[model samples]
Target chain A: MRSVVSILDLSTSEINELMNVADDIERNPEFYRSKCKHKILATIFYEPSTRTRLSFESAMLSLGGSVISTPDSKISSAAKGESISDTVRVISNYADIIVMRHPKEGAPVVAAMKATVPLINAGDGGHFHPTQTLADILTIRRTKKTLSGLTIGLCGDLMFGRTVHSLIEAMLRYPDNKYIMISPNELKLPEYMREALDKAGVSWRETESLETAMPELDVLYMTRVQKERFFNEEDYVRLKDVYILDRDKLKTAKSDLAILHPLPRVNEISVAVDDDPRAQYFYQTLCGKQMRMALIMLLLGII
Target chain B: MNIDGVNNGIVLDHIKAGESMLVYDYLKLGRLKCCVAIIQNCQSKKMGLKDIVKIDELIDIDLDVLGYIDPHITVNYVKDGKLLKKRHLALPETLTNVIKCKNPRCITSTEQELPHVFKLIDREKQIYRCAYCDVVGDNK
Candidate 1:
């Protein structure tokens, strides 16, 4: 694909090919550090962000590429009502590739249409975060050393957790990847996603109880119940602390079980678990940078 | 039991019962200067009961909207009181600007010029999701 607007734009082999590149970069950092020597990476963020914006910038710098960025659209010309298409059209002239995050679900898609340079969607509202999925898959592949033959429990905010949605979709492409959806009934995944799993022949079951599903899981992907996504604060409050994972909860899980989160987390994961070797969220954060590196390299044909 | 046929016009047949007026209003058949006959809950051999919209003037009709509204609709072209062409409708694989995307955060919401596109994800369930954000559309 010329641009990565969605994870579905990538295939299983291409996913692996990128992982291989990320793996190599991890092993030989100095050798590949100067690969994007003369290139420019632009980060266009129309929404407030932390990890994703920093991750893309960090990835670009690690590749020895320079970056031009709009970390906040409020401060940019967008505040004066410049269109995303016009913004992308202007930015494509200055950057070799664009990594954009927007509060609107398909804003990057609109950017991808207008961009001459390749576009990478860092996160587009509650749509798809393909690069985050890349980090997720990379972390999962390295931690478990395989993408298949495991049960992954995606807990909390499944309804608005785009990462969970993207991760489930990406992981289902592999052989025998089972999913256990753990969430309150109010936050169950959309019916279409369940139907998609059914059509794909991926085995999955939904449960309200995390403790019930904990022992069987090989991986637990925890997501924050986002305050901004809620139309009602009461519903968010009721479901927010529904599944706080503490040491007591981890006692039932497998010893090698990997805990992953797309970070800047609110207490979905107890900081107590951060000390546990099973907590791979920090490593996943680092993988976020490496995966973006591999992604930029792939999109720019540096690999 | 013969319903009067139209000459040099269009006939929408086999529409789901009680949906003719919505179709009539949706297609904006009121704008037609010529005779427009809307026959609802008519006895049909194939469908048991159906709705028919007969336009006595040849006006541009959106087959996609008719198909999207009800896949079982049959569109017939008539000239000189003889049927020239007839076709049945099926659910469209993709739709543009037919239904507003329900997701508040969807691209179509903020990007006012963006086409609200949806792709049919489940044929049996007649389910369509917004192409941009994967938010399921109201298939109603």
Candidate 2:
């Protein structure tokens, strides 16, 4: 069975195909209303996440599919000490497809190894979040019309943001997609990421100032400074408020720039910017559902 | 100094000087009951100095660990005091339970039964990344 543990699992052509399906789903929701009539999706969140879990549930329900979920690991069999392998093995019998989020990195990989059905990694600890990358790309495709030749400005926590990492990997597959990585010195992109960009021969530059990179970008992807990812509370507190995107900051940004945040955002993006048409983060949520629906259908081989 | 050749055994040659002890530790040579000789700092022409390990039994050793430690090392299988086959080494594609991941957030760290796995991502740099957390790890 196919399992999406990372963004690299899907080829560029496959991603484009999935996006095409997502676009069709967005335009004609009634056509896909009962596409997954009898299928059951298992949503297992080992970590407490409001947006991703709910998004998966909503996507399944919208497709006329049933969902069985364990939204909180604290109250599930995990709290009593069950391995991801055993849980997935059991869940596979009950569900046709599985989507999981875990605080431990590569937890879904373990689940994927044991699952009989298709497995989707919703999110993993400070690692890959392939679904969010799908959503970001879909949003970009909707507004920008092409995945290539755009200046993508990544702001806030580049170091520990799984969404940022996943997005960069996805975008690297396209041609001429320059990256302007804007983050504080302490939260700069990891050395491996820099090496990857250098190896790929992509145009990428790192800067401390978000405002400086704002004018050059076609897409500005903002990220939250997650408290859970930091080993030190002091570091999290110091960096959490470092890059707040208020309306004043947007004044220097391109009018056509699409602002995105893989959210449950905590003070990183200001409420004032929500009124701007350029702020597409909320709409990004809808894109997430559509892409997930497309992905579920593809993995289940129903479409 | 000279050591007796085993009738049926394996010989490890051309190990970089000062790394034989590491090879010994990694291969758990101390746990073996058979005769094992770790010859250190021997003369060499190809290399300035080298080490050799001679084992008195044809026991299976982890070639991946050996290759990761030093790819230049030569393995000679012996049967009845005659050389059977010579094996060369290269960095392994994947290593299972060979090295533990230090990343605290990796699934292998908490899961006691999970095999610690690493994959060679960069052959030029000899870089191996943990399969779970994608953190760079050394052979040590």
Candidate 3:
């Protein structure tokens, strides 16, 4: 009866269980290959997201599940003026589960209200991407081997990065995990998140200078400074390359430190860092698939 | 022109004239067993145009829901042709429990069993944000 809507929805115990399931899937691929056989996953993407949508589809297909999807909303009945609730209600009758991505902030919530099956929010506006948080958590745990007692640096696009917001919420649940937020004043984390962190008693600091905080961080999580997110071209031009992870920055960071980025990079990370032993972005991408597979199996009660 | 007041009931006054139906739908008052009256498009000196609703019994009205739907509603409790309590419902500083946020990508929106909670972050702005997603949307 549970649904994976937000990273916050899963308690510490449930998250550990999900990570354990993901770990098991990573260790034994053959055992879960046919876990979702004959089941259908309906991906109703109202917005454009190639990687997230493809990963979900690949994860389901890898588990022997079929995908019924509209990769683009322009091609779907949504272009004909159908409400998300109406579309999901009809889709729920045909599919066992629904994964939705919408431009509007609460489109997934509206769909879940009308859906009879489990609803997964792929992305909703600038609000939340819980599955991405799962991938991030899994990657963090795999890289660090522990979720607690680490000084994590979240740099760039803090305001609009849904992944960063969700990840911060997830990490705040762990004890002794400090945060070093590196972003310009305009792109600082929202007041609500800062308040939540304060309430949770998590130690955190904000700095526009990433170099000052780099050497102390156990994990440096970088996010793209999206041009579309900026209100104007001038702000985008001024701050877009403020925190690029080049060799100079990497020299300041600890050799044991891991660098993570939610992919589809736009020059925030240098291509040269691909060979660094600490660069785990490629591994993070693979973890996304396995984590999604685990999520699919768990949701379908096959695991 | 004077509309006949209900014999003994709760009266919701000062609602935006055309928004009475929205308030009704928001409260799901149509499903209630109590007798109800929706007076719309009435002339008002203060608000230009106003609406009123009268219910036959005392029900626990969710003030947060009222705040979200129409913060202007003034609730009046009438007993034996006398106003017992006449008060303007103030929006909560934080809406912990009342009114589900309409955002699906929000955690509270997707989880079937979780309470649909929102907090009133700014009263003057008529803004309510999802406690889970931090998605802010206007109520008015």
Give lDDT: candidate 1, residue A291. 88
Task: Report backbone clashes per prediction.
Answer: 0, 0, 6
Judge candidate 2 at residue A245 and give its lDDT: 96
Top TM-score hit? 2
Alpha-carbon runs more than 4 Å astray in model 2: none
Across A127-182, the per-residue lDDT of candidate 3 in tens digits comes to 67888888898999999999999999999999888789889989988889999999
TM-score of chain A of each: 0.98, 0.98, 0.97
True contacts kept of 2: 0.69
Error of 2 at A25 (Å): 1.2
Alpha-carbon runs more than 4 Å astray in model 1: B1-4
Could you estimate the TM-score for every candidate? 0.95, 0.98, 0.77
Candidate 1 lDDT over A1-303, as tens digits, reads 389998988988999999998899899999888999999999998888888888999999999999998746777988988889999999999999998988888888888989999999988877788999999999999999999899999999898888988898899889998899999999999776787788888889999999999999999999999988888989878888998999999999999999999987898888899999999999998888988999899899988
Location of the lowest summed lDDT over 10 successive residues in candidate 1 chain A: A69-78
Q: What fraction of the native interface does candidate 3 get right in terms of contacts? A: 0.23
Name the weakest run of 10 consecutive residues (lDDT summed) in model 3 chain B.
Answer: B103-112
Whole-model Cα lDDT of every candidate shown, in order: 0.88, 0.92, 0.83
lDDT of 2 by residue, A1-303 (tens): 899999999998889999999999988999999999999999999888888988998999999999998847898999989999999999999999999999888888888999999999999998999999999999999989999999999999999899999999999999999999999999899877888899999999999999888889999999999999898999999889999999999888888999999998989999998999999999999999999999999898977
Give Cα distance to truth, residue B80, candidate 2, Å.
Answer: 2.3
- Provide the lowest-lDDT 10-residue window in model 2 chain B: B131-140
